[model samples]
Target: MKYIKIRIPKATVYFTPVEIEKLLNKNIEITNKLLTQQTEIFKEGLKRGKCFIRSSKQKIREERKI
Candidate 1:
């Protein structure tokens, strides 16, 4: 199996495609659970947020010094 490398704040994680898919699924499940448990807060017109893709890419490049 081919492995891909993922770098986070202070660590690198290696994952095969299958393992990556499983990890994403697990994250979705956990996120769903948290959202359900906090329905009231979410329903109060709170918007979900994400890092800007370009900014995130730049940050990763800076961290990796590549």
Candidate 2:
């Protein structure tokens, strides 16, 4: 048997290449869409006062919960 490994911020998981490719493609598609409409997205978020950040402690807590 063969394996593929993915290292996320707080966790690692193994997947088959096909699964990884699918995930990668999906993420790329979503990212591209977001970029195309980034201004509108930002405007909407600003209107709602919503935002996100990369938080290590939050990642650690989520990983521990998982």
Candidate 3:
């Protein structure tokens, strides 16, 4: 199979291409763990950035209203 699907927490839809699997000797566990960790970090950073932007915009709108 060129691609393999893994079922992991917040990583159920992850697909590893054969090239990477071969590089890791067909060990998908490490790949999934690394991917999930990276995904979590990215999501957290995005959430924090978006929340800050939204709050700033809301403050601007409120200032205009008053």
Candidate 4:
């Protein structure tokens, strides 16, 4: 038997400002902070994924030249 391990990125959708105000009626300041944090997380994840992909491509090129 063979085993394969895969990593799947997970995501969560946050409430839009209108929805937050209408439904939850949370403070605007807090909601803005939460949204900012979520955006930062997404940006960081993208950076990591791009770096990994670039490194993998480089390794493949290096291997082929050998």
- Best prediction by TM-score: 4
Tens digit per residue, CA lDDT, model 2, 1-66? 567987999999999888878999999999999897998888888866533443656788899999
Candidate achieving higher TM-score, 2 or 3:
3
Candidate 3 C-alpha lDDT tens digits along 1-66: 445667778666545685655767646777888999999999999999999999999999999999
Of models 1 and 4, which has the larger TM-score? 4
Worst 10 residues of 2 by lDDT: 48-57
Quote each prediction's TM-score.
Answer: 0.51, 0.47, 0.51, 0.59
Global Cα lDDT for candidate 4: 0.77
Prediction RMSDs, each to the true structure: 20.8, 19.3, 11.9, 19.0
Range of the 10 consecutive residues with the lowest summed lDDT in candidate 4? 1-10
Name the TM-score of candidate 2. 0.47
lDDT of 2: 0.82
TM-score of 1: 0.51
lDDT of 1 by residue, 1-66 (tens): 799999999999999999989989999999999988799676554443233666777899999996
By summed lDDT, the worst window of 10 consecutive residues in model 3 runs over 12-21
